[model samples]
Every structure is written in structure tokens, then in C-alpha cells.
Target: MKYFFFMLAAAPLSVCCQTLVHAQVISKSTQQAIPFATVGLVKQNNGTTTDEIGSFKIQCRSIEDSIIISAVGFKTARVAVSVVLSARKIELEENLVLLEEVSISWRNKAKPTTLNDFVHCPTNYYSVGLGTYRQVAQRFLAPRASMRLQSIRLCKMAGKATFRVRVYAMDSITGMPSTDLLSKELLINSSDKNVYIDLQENIVLPDRDFFIAVEWLFISSNEFRVKAKIDRQKISYSNYAPRLSFKKLTGIPTQNNCRMLNFNGSWQKPENYDSNHVFMIAAELGSQ
Candidate 1:
């Protein structure tokens, strides 16, 4: 897993001095409107904070201005004034936990010298089936040890109105779905949705890996057309090695109601554990 820090930019204010835009920011998780979240104009200093109901009123001179909304522990969002005026509400997802920093030099030295020294040789699996629309699959591989799975985020794209997601594991060699792991369903709106799906399972030989499969259903009843993306990050420490991996998928949609996507990979560690050493692998999939 590779970790990277990102900085968000604010939106710009309008120059017309007419037409006020009222915007609301809500948490996708708690659903109890968020208060005191920061909302500001990009490239300008003008800003305001949400009130008790996670709502704010801004005076926009024109619809061309952009607005930047942010809160501690949440990912910052930038929206155009036009979008703010058109939509009655907005939701934001929480930021995934940042992986603990580890120097690269230590990891390079800790690379397993032989296949037998590898610790957690866990395999990760992911699959997507679109009803005559699209297809996708994904997987992650790593040596089992102590690790933390951070935020799992879903972003809805254009033409996609609604969708469903599930997380599960499977048998390593047979590729058969396993019910031993917990699974959850995720509902995504136009705004971002963040779900926490952390597991503390120990992966040794015989078990081989944890498989997570996501199933997506596009709601076409409302003539809804949309796409979605998934972002995941994990940090773990093994007795012999430390590793981090981040995976992201974007522009996923049902193309013909029969599309599918898949991912498969693995991680290896040395016999001796070292905290200073960290190996990272980033797996990503997105629209063309």
C-alpha cells in the first residue's frame, strides 16, 4: 500500500453581487447534520461555517462562483455555484485514516530473501457484474499480521442515480465465495458515501486470503443514470515486515447489464519483523 497526502482547494466567489445561494452540508455516516463545518469561496477568503442543522447561506453575485466545503476528519468538497443552487442538499464522506509513515530504506532491506520466509500470503478478491452495462473485478494480496483497514468510499458519477455495494471474502485457490467473513451493503447517492469495513482476521497458510466482492445495481426506474468509484486504504504490521496498500476504482457503471471487473494480487514478508521497513502496493481501476 502506498500512502499520499492531498491538499484541497477552495472555490471562488462571484462578482455579480446579486443572487444569494444557500447550501447545506451533511455527514453521510451519522445523518445528524454536521455543524461548524467550514464553507468558503475558492481562490478567495470569503467563507462561513455551517449552523446547527449543517446549513449555510451565502451571498453569491453569480452562479459562476465555486464553493469549497470542508470539516475536520472529512474530505473537502468543491462545487460550482450553479450546482449549489440547483441541488437542495450536499453530503460529504469522511477521510480515510492516514497510514503510519515508514521509511523506504528499511523496507528495501526487509524484502523476503526466500519464498519460505514470507509471512502473510493473503489474497484479496473483488468482482462487479453490471446488468447489460459494465463489468469489473479487483483483488489485494499481503502477508498477514497486525493491520488497520481504513475508510471505504463510494462516489456516484453522472447518469447513475442509485447503487448497492457488498463486501465479502472467499477461498484462495477455488475462488469460491466464503461466508466466514462479514459483509455489508452500501447505498450511494450523488454525494459521497463512506463506510467502515475493518476486519481483524489472521491470515496464515491453508486460509490463504480474504476476498471482498462488491455488487452494484443501477436504479433505472427514475431514468437514473450514474457511475461510481471506490477507494480503500490499509495499514498493517507483521512480525517480519510492515506493509501498506491503497486501492481505488472509478467510472464504474453497467454498460449492458452484463459487465464485470476483477482484481487479484498478493503480498510477501520476511522472517524478521521490522517497524521501520514498509512495502507498498497501490491497486487502482477507473473509467477510460
Candidate 2:
């Protein structure tokens, strides 16, 4: 039997997309670092998060490309890559926007398929891998209207895992996830093996198709807050990149198989993956 190793990687070419830069996002008036900030390249899908203390390094195509920084309670920040690189630190003002009304159907009928891969995670490396990042986006359809995303259900490997989840409408041409539904994305701190996290967003949905995206914030380092899990019995994965278990499908997928990727910096999608991950990621939706 042929074995497949699940990992995402990018080329080592010395191109504009390979240029790396670092920045620290903090409160402008208070001079305090903002933790869990979403920093990324504008006009592109490539992005990453700041550590608990508000520090991060990102790969950019060039100093000409724009960089965007956004946090839960602060106003979004956008600046030129050259300007941010020159400044080394960014300060965003806080915005106290109220959470929207939440509506989630707690019925088991609304529960998504529970898939599991029983794979173990490596405990050494900080993030998912040395030069890679892991993302799981599953294709799903909203059955009813008056839906607001309430929570995401998943199984944690061991200790606490901090990740960011985003809901997107699928693209029309490529069939991938479209733009981030909300210009701003929320951060999540998951800490249990199998539990539902109350996602604090009041997003209304229609009876249409969508995708649930999960980005693992596994940075490999003792200097920052560690969110890595461990397991001895299952197949061990590298610490450099996150290894979320997948729910193996016995039959072929009707639409897109749960999208899996191991990317090194730039945005690259897998060509032909027929299997779904045991990420067991589910969302709670309720009507208004």
C-alpha cells in the first residue's frame, strides 16, 4: 500500500513573494502589544497571526504590497509594507463594537458529520512546521435561513489550542472560498478535547453554500504562549506545522473534498485531494 504524507510547502525561489518582514502590532495610544492580531498582505489571501504578546513575522511579495492588521476589539490597520517594515511596530486604536444577536439550533439534526483520523501531533516544533502553515476549509451548505454562526465544534488533541475560524461564501469561478465574509475576523482560544466553543459573532446566513475555514495558530517557541498538543499512540506529525486529525470518508465527496494545504508563505491550494480531514469542525447557526 502506498502511504501519503500530509504536509504543505512552498518553493525556495528568491522571488518577490519570498521576501520576509516582521512587525509588532500594539495599541497606538497605550503603547501595548495587541495579541492575536490578524496580519496579512492586502489584495492577497496570505496572512498570519501575532503571538500572545503581539509580535509576528510575515512573508511579503515586495515592499510595495500593502499589509493589513486587524484585531477583535480594535480598528483594522492597513499600511504599505515598506512603511510598516521601516516602523517595525504598528498601533491600532480600540473599538468596542457590540456582539450581534446569536441564533444557533442546538438540535442534533443540525450537527455536521463527525470525522476522525486519530492522528497524533508532534510536540517539539512551535507552529505547524518550519516553512509551512496548515488550513482546513470544508464545503457546506446552509439548510435554513435566519442563521447566525454561534460556535465551532471540534476535538482538541491535548492542551489548549488557539486558532482563528472564518466563514466564507464559496467562489464562483474557482470553487474555493471567496473573500473573508466580514472584513474583520475573530480569534478563538480552544482548550478542550471535544467541545463546542461559543463563537462571539452575529452573522446572518441564507440557505446557500459556504465554507468553514480553520487556521491553526501553532507557533513553535517557548518564548510565546504555546498551544501544541501531544499524543503517543497515533501517527506523529511535525511540530513546524499543525496536524489536525481528519475524518476519512468511506465514499467519495459529492462536491469538494475537505480542502487541505501545507503552504510555505504564499497562498497555494492542493490540486486533487479526495479525502476530508477529521478536523470535525462544525458551526452553530440560529435564525433571527
Candidate 3:
């Protein structure tokens, strides 16, 4: 993605027949209005930039289209167009820290005994790889409470191949895994090789822990599968951690059958981690 620095100016009058919504995008920390922020209708691709006051008016063809607001040095925001038209004004809180450059090292060259052993509570572990594509999955549990899976980090394995990555989420209690709560397909190319897919869910679980899974495919071909799973364990005061596992399944490994290389471990959330919060660090692979 290209990043540009610009200031927004005054708002223009609404055009006829189009539905208009007013919005203001601001930096969460500086509290200063961000101008020239990109605000557009996701479905229709019609958008406008914020003025110097960090305010912009977007005109959409219909209420079904969603309004996506984005700015440099800020996290992207999306909301239903109908809601914005009804409310007249929407405010977005931006995340100051974007992705930082880091290095990755691979280890534990052995295969996994069982996939079940890969399941652990969610902590703060991050993984990266590349091939034809990528995928990620996570499970959060709070039997009586509800939570949201906010952001995820993904990148290509250097010197390897680049591929498309897809993500999916489901309820662990359901007998059939085909019932997906959400699914998004992504294109990872040379220009935008490393991508971060953020998930926002408002669903409430029957309890604290749930399952999340992500699968990466070779574009439209499912010749190989690279998957990740995280089991989230609830502690106290809304604090939780993840047990992380990374696996790679290749068609040629088991005579064209899928074979997995698994890494098993757990991660700990720092005392001050929040939903929009992110911590950057490096990873070193260890031999089994």
C-alpha cells in the first residue's frame, strides 16, 4: 500500500440523488484532526478525502454499500453506509503504530504427532511464512462471556514462493466445521507480498474458549495447505493468552497426500495489552 501525507480542506455541498454521510477521522493519540484521509464506499468505490478539519462527506449510491475510512498513520475504519447516513456523523480512532520491519528464523524441523496437541490457549505468539499462499485460525473461550478477535499479522517466507491466503472462523461447538462465521480471501503478490488481515467480530460465545482456523491455498489450486490455530484461554479480568501452532501440508510429501510440519507452543499477553494494541518482536526456530 502506498502512503501519502496530505491535509484535508473544507467540505463540498452534497450532490443530488446520492445519499450523503458526514464523518470525521482523527488520530487517537494526538486528538488532532487528520485531513486528506481516504473515505469511500467499499461496494461502489465512490469516496472522498477529509478536509483540513478531518471532516468529510461521502455520497453513496445506496445504503447497502459500506463506508471505509482510511488515513496515513491511522488504522482503517469501515461502517455500514445506512448507519452513517442515519447518524450523520461518525468518528474513527486510528492506530498509530503500523507494521514494523522484522526478521524470522525457522526451527523444529520434525513432523507433528497429532493435530490436537497443537491446540493451546491464546497468548502472544506470531508466525510468518511464504509459499503459494497462507492461512490462519484462532479459538477463544469464555463460556459465559463474549470477545472479539481484532488483528492478525501475516507475511511471505522470503526466497520462497508468493501465494494467495484465505481466513475463516467458526464455532467450535458445531459438529460440522463447514459452517463459517466469516471468511475473507486475500491476494499476496510481489508488490504487496506481506499483508496483515484484521478481523472484527461481534458474536458472543456460549463460554470463554472457541476455535479459530486459517487456511492458505495456491491461488485457486488447493495443492498445498499451510494452516495456523490458536486456542484462547481466559484467565482473569478479561486477560487471555494463546497456544500457537504452525503447520505446513504439502501434496508431494505423503505421495501427494498432505503432510504437516508442526510447531507447538504458548504465548503470554503483556500486562498492558489492549484490543487495538500491538507488540513487535522477532522469532527464532529451535530444533526438536
- lDDT by candidate, in order shown: 0.37, 0.56, 0.37
Runs off by more than 4 Å, candidate 1: 1-16, 97-288
* C-alpha TM-score for every candidate: 0.29, 0.61, 0.28
**Candidate 2 vs 3: which has more lDDT:** 2
Per-residue lDDT of model 3, residues 156-257, tens digit only: 222233333222233344421223333332323332223344333223333344334433322212122222222664221110011122233334432111
lDDT of 2: 0.56
Give the 10-residue window scoring lowest on summed lDDT in candidate 1.
Answer: 236-245
Global fold similarity of model 3 (TM-score): 0.28
- Per-residue lDDT, model 1, residue 68, is 74
Please tell me which predicted candidate would have the highest lDDT against the true structure. 2
Residue lDDT tens for model 2, 1-288: 112233333233224365678989999878998876667666444566788789988777667788777665578778888888789899898776522223322344342322221234322222343234445677766656556665566544545556666677766676676655643454444444454555555566543566777776645431132232336433334442223444445565544445543332233355655544334556656656
When 1 and 2 are scored with lDDT, the better candidate is 2
Lowest-lDDT window of 10 residues in candidate 2?
221-230
- lDDT of candidate 1 at residue 112, scale 0 to 100: 29
If both were scored by TM-score, which would come out higher, candidate 1 or candidate 3? Answer: 1
Query: How do all the candidates rank in terms of TM-score, highest first?
Result: 2, 1, 3
